[model samples]
Target: MARQSLAERRRQLTEAAIRAMTRDGVARTTTRSIAAEAGVSLSVFHYCFDSKQVLLESVIEAITEHYITVVKEAIRPRATLRETVRAGFQAYWDHVHAHPGEHMLTYELTQYALRQPGFEHLARRQYELYADTYTGLIEELGRSMDFELRVPAPTLARYLAAMTDGLTLSLLVLGKDAVPASADILDTITEHVASLVGDEPARQSTEVAGGTA
Candidate 1:
């Protein structure tokens, strides 16, 4: 195969690291194991990342991006506002359902980071990414659809992130057998969230055009 750029190589190793961490827990996964998982030499892994901490940071970012991309696409102003909201939630649920191990790894990474000295910031960054992701999605909807938030965008974003975090954790704790029941709860919460917004009148699209005009 041709040579991979440093960015490409880092991405390759990061993906491998995610898989390793997901399968073997953050505490169990090591630079050597990650290198092996990527089918590259340990020297190459060292060259790409300064330390395992850096590698973990990369994995944190990559995994967050992994799921948010799906939600972003899912929230693209669907046929109805409620449908759009449901799609975003469903997209997130689908990811957790399909990759339970990957989703579980996120919680593990957070706990691992918190317990490791000088690594607490990683846990903070992880949740911050969650809020930031929601902030972007909320803003995207504000720019596209007709609605105003019940609270400020940042507030709602964090709330959504926290709420989803709990929901996801409950799913993991309850196991796959509770899938049907969780869907009911998710649907109720999604509708309640949707109800909180969408009270304002007219298209958010026209508001932007009128302002920029």
Candidate 2:
């Protein structure tokens, strides 16, 4: 269908933009490069996105959605809140390990947006979207476990955002060498999350190991 083709074209451009941004960095990624990466003409790229900013936003959305999906999938009802938290964090780390370039590109894009004056709002909105999604997950998990977070879910989400950013940056700098030591950080988070809940354990789900959420 024409509609499906149009959507596919847009998806292709978005993916191409992500690859270009990751490989070339924001400063060097131009419309022509992205169009070439997508195997489409510059006009087709323009048809999909009015401007580079729009394309960057689309790439951000895709990357963020993938992150949320993985984290949500990673968290499930477990024998203990600690295990649940560990699973989520570990899954997040796994995703970062698997897609280091995307993780790096995310921060690159955030910084790029921040420096663009008028486009700073895009960075803010991106983080807000992350915070909101993470907060909702925390609330849902808390309700399921009959335990509330020590801090507000939004506050905890913000804390998590900072933690993940640091962890990801470490990976970007140190590469795979950072993995073993990152366990200590994950352990600290698990202990903190465990402390938030009551003694009661959550009802374990039939499926463990964080099946798709």
**Top-scoring candidate (lDDT):** 1
After superposition, the stretches of candidate 2 with alpha carbons farther than 4 Å from their true spots are: 1-5, 197-213
Cα lDDT of model 1 by residue, 48-130, tens digit: 99987888889989988999999888989877788889889999988888888888999999999999999999999899988
TM-score of each: 0.91, 0.85
1-213: candidate 2 lDDT, tens digit per residue: 354487789888888888998899988999999999988899988888887677877888889888779888888888777888899989998899999999999888889899987788779878887787778888778777666456767788887788788888988899868887888988987887666544354323423424645
In model 1, which residue pairs have backbone atoms overlapping below 3 Å?
none
What TM-score number comes out for model 1?
0.91
Model 1 local distance difference test score: 0.87
Clashes of 2: 0
lDDT of each structure? 0.87, 0.81
* Alpha carbon lDDT at 175, candidate 2: 89
Clash number by candidate, in order: 0, 0
